[model samples]
Target chain A: MIELLLILCIVAAIIAIESKNLLSSIISLGGVGFSLAIIMLFLSAPDVAFVQILVEVVMLIILIRATINRDVTEVKCKREFFGMIFGMALVTVLLGILLMGIQTLPEFGTALVNASAESVPAKYYIENGLAQTGSANIVTGVLLDYRAYDTLGEATVLFTAIIGAIAILRKKKTNE
Target chain B: MNILPLFVTIPLAGAFVVSLFDFIKDEKKKNISTNIFASLAGLVLLVISIKVIGSAGVYSMGKWKLPEGIVLVLDPFSGPILLITNLISFICILFSFDYMSGYNGREKYYSLFFLMVAGMNGLVLTGDIFNLYVFLEIASVASYALVGFGTMREEIEATFKYMVLSSVATAFMLLGVAFIYGFTFNLNMVSVAKALGSMEAPVGVYVALGLFIIGFSIKSALIPFHAWLPDAHPSAPAPISAMLSSVVIKTVGMYSLIRICYVVFGMNTGQVPEVLRVLGILSMMLGVLLALGQWDFKRLLAYHSVSQMGYIALGFGLGTPLGVIGGIYHLLNHSVFKSLLFLNSGAVYYRTGTRDLKEMGGLGKKMPVTGATSMIASMSIAGIPPFNGFWSKLIIIMACIKSSHPWLAFWAVLGSILTLASFLKVQRYGFLGKVKDSLRNVKEAPFMMQVSMITLALLCLAMGGLMLPGLYDLIFVPAAGIILDQAQYLKLVLGN
Candidate 1:
């Protein structure tokens, strides 16, 4: 039943994405995001659901504002609608195939639960990372202690993007 | 006095100062204040990056213990990127000193610039996935605003398009992180990798990886997702064109992709590189093919940015040591030459007031320095020997052939030839042709611009020496080593 809802939600999202009015399209996109968050919650993954909510809200607000201010015209061509339908059908078929393939997957949960439940270091650190890293957060411990270098590189990339944006966006004014 | 926090704090402080200047009544006072803050702050970042490189170790934020609180990870991999960030940032700031003189709201521009740097530095240093997202958004949002800074028709339109595409990419990334966090009950990349190591791969894990690939691919402007580059890159100023084409796409898009795909998720089941190879070949062929017909100089360069990035992807995608080395070498070379080329175009615009090569001619005699430096950049990009681009391109081609993918090498070589042909068109029309009657008296760019261009051009020559034994070990080898060892990363976190 839950799977069915997810399929329906995705179908609705595709429709929302295809909506001619920019406002409705954005709204539908938000609806899709919200429903996905709900589906994640039902799957007992509250953390994923929470992040989904945050993302959904942010995306909806930004896209709505942008589209309202956009220079949109009528979707006057039937070919575009045909292209959209063809694309959607292709996606649906691909996803259906993937869902069918999932039956072949092994029982990952039991295996992980058994393997990690035994003597993995993760069991110790999840409970005691704060004491080990001197930071109050376990998440911090993992990012900084175990893989600080990756984080560092990621940050530099962000810095580079900012510089790029600033350089690209610098403006010139003229007296009218 | 701890250096890790200073990386974030200084830029944050710089942003504040820029904003403070914006509140000032006098325009001249505001401009001077912003420039002084930006320049000094950039110099400080440069010095600090050098110092951080010298003393290589991870520093947990707020004296937090491992896996607790926020942590700032510093290592050899990050060392060169820090230097790259600070160095290019300082140069871009210097370029802005003269370039932005004609623009409005100098303080706002400076403020956003510093904030973006701060966000990026924080993102690179933070080890947690969620923190990375926050920092990514900080940088992304600032970029969106900056892209629309001009408020001109094209600039505003480009900004909107870039914002939408980027927001979707970010959403996908956040969703990926969310899935990972749910699967592992943790947001730290190392912890997640550790969890992933001992367990059978879950369906959710595959989903998360798929999301990351799509997210970062879009951000990195990989071929299919490259709609925003030409419009966005050329919409901004010349220095920005350099920043966007050279570093932004690599750092934001490619760097994150590497971190998540290689370090965090522990390789793509051996299929990820294959996917990258296909995309690389597509981008290489299509980007240049599209560029061949362009008349705008910067627009042409933007298309080539996509093409050059394809080379980097191809190298890394080969998944061999030689390929990885070649990919990274190409990355460094591309950054230097691409930025120099953009700056050269900016200089051309500064004097001639046009970006169309067709309207330009024979002012090479008048602007000897710009002319000479642009030629060096052009040759380097076109894969001429003795310049940096040649060595890296050769390595990538050889790695492909060595790996028995002669077809990939053929495509890379073909792309190089096309790149040369297009750039020659630039040379013929923009610099080497008959001097336009209207542009006869145009002057060279200001001293600072000239200095930055010449320095970068010289670096182009020097970078070829990096393929030398000791030099390779010093820089590219360590970086490549980081990617090659997936288990070491697992041990680093679990060991901690």
Candidate 2:
């Protein structure tokens, strides 16, 4: 089931990238996001899945709004066949290298018992997180208590993005 | 007191306050409040950085132990970077006091500026890889917005290009981090290093390293991955340009690259050094060659930034004690002079409303302060004796020769000489000749702007003195020592 969902995600991503119309591409992107959210659920990360779905919906709406009154068709430029071939070849090489590298990695769900896994930070967090942070949910404890600074930094990123959008899109008043 | 968290908190709180100032309605009140908040945040950070110098500690969040919690490590590596980030940011904020007035959304500008500062400070100080990525995004996103702050066509285009390229880079970096996590089951630097150090070499490690190199090379605007820099740097307002060129690339790009390569991956052995040296030389030559043809004032300086960063990369690539020192010192020196140069360009644009070098001449007579400071900056960047740039460039070249790479040294020398020639062109065309009729009435930059420029110019002059034994030991030595002896860093953070 997860494999099928993953394949669906990939297909949606390719469609999103290849679609000529901006709206359909965006909708395909939504399709990709939804499949990703479902895969997250299969992985037992329901919190991530929930957030992913919410963000995907918000993003789809935003993209739709942006496309309104704009040219829906992506302008097709002169295709550089050589460049395309070169890019594809490079991608193939990189993918091959990455796959070779991944072959040596521990299989999924088995990493916790791997030789060096005793020292992994997540193990410590899982065991002591609730006690350390007074939160029953270990994830919250990790995010809010043990790694609160990361949360702070993440908040700042969101704030910065908002400020940036406002800085870019705010209507200018002419009078001094 | 644990002042580590405050570094990220104050500017964030200040950003929040400045955003609320949007409701104040009175522009003057809004402006004053924003200024006060920015200055206060800057002042506090400046003082804290000064207070924390020469000290190193780990502040684990929520009172959790190091292995269990996110830690902010204040080591020698972070000390100089934090100091430079705060000092330059404070100066840039001062310059922006007057320089940013013409732009709309003053509050939004300050808010994003402080957030960028917060992001950089966090990036410098964070000891966790994932945490670093989050902060890196914060800084990158804020800069993307700030780069397009003008809302002009070129600015928007540049911002879009920058955003796309940077997002790709970020994606690559995240993939690399994922690989690292899969390999070591750790996100903390010390833990990852420990795990990787104890294990046999894995193919995954090399792959992760490659991704990190490509990702950070883009961030640092190194030769191959530097497409976004020249466009993005010049499109932003002057102070933002200064910040982006001077510190942003260094902190997120070079510093992280160095830390990951040396401390995390252990740089003493491998093809990494050779790759770094080759990339460095390529960037050095290409950046200067590209810079020589540019006539736009800020654009020229942007290209020079890439060229100078090459020198830093070359120094680090050597992987000797002296090489590390040279690289770190060059990083510091470049931030000072490059920022001063950008501010000088900004002042010129402020007065004459033109960045075209050909349109301005004899501005030396009218704007003596701007011209003089710019001359100082130009000389500094050109590596003339007695300025900061000369010392660092000399050390890097000397390190090159000492490392038995005379060809690299030769390339370094040629790059510097070419840099001098182009800057002489800048001096001759932009400041020395006949003033265009339209620019005849141009005045010197305003007081706040002049003060910031002068202070930075003086800093350029004074930075050479940092090579003195006492100051060198105080500042650059420990910083370089951290990278040179990766074990020391691991021990310092993990207390093994």
What's the i-RMS of each model?
7.6, 2.4
Candidate 2: CAPRI quality band? medium
Candidate 1 lDDT tens digits, B267-375? 8348888888988898889999999999998899999999999999899899887898898889879989999999999888887888887788886877999999999
Give one digit per residue, the lDDT tens place, for model 1 in A39-144: 8888766766897999899888867776676677334445577787898897797577546434434443542354342333455566666766777666566567
Worst ten in a row by lDDT for model 2 chain A: A111-120
Predicted model with the maximum TM-score: 2
Error of 2 at B84 (Å): 0.9
The lDDT per prediction is 0.78, 0.89
**Runs off by more than 4 Å, candidate 1:** A1-80, A90-176, B490-496
Question: Candidate 1 chain B, which ten residues in sequence have the lowest lDDT sum?
Answer: B61-70
Docking quality band of candidate 1, CAPRI definitions: incorrect
DockQ of 1: 0.13
lDDT of 1 at A115: 36
Per-model B-chain TM-score? 0.96, 0.99
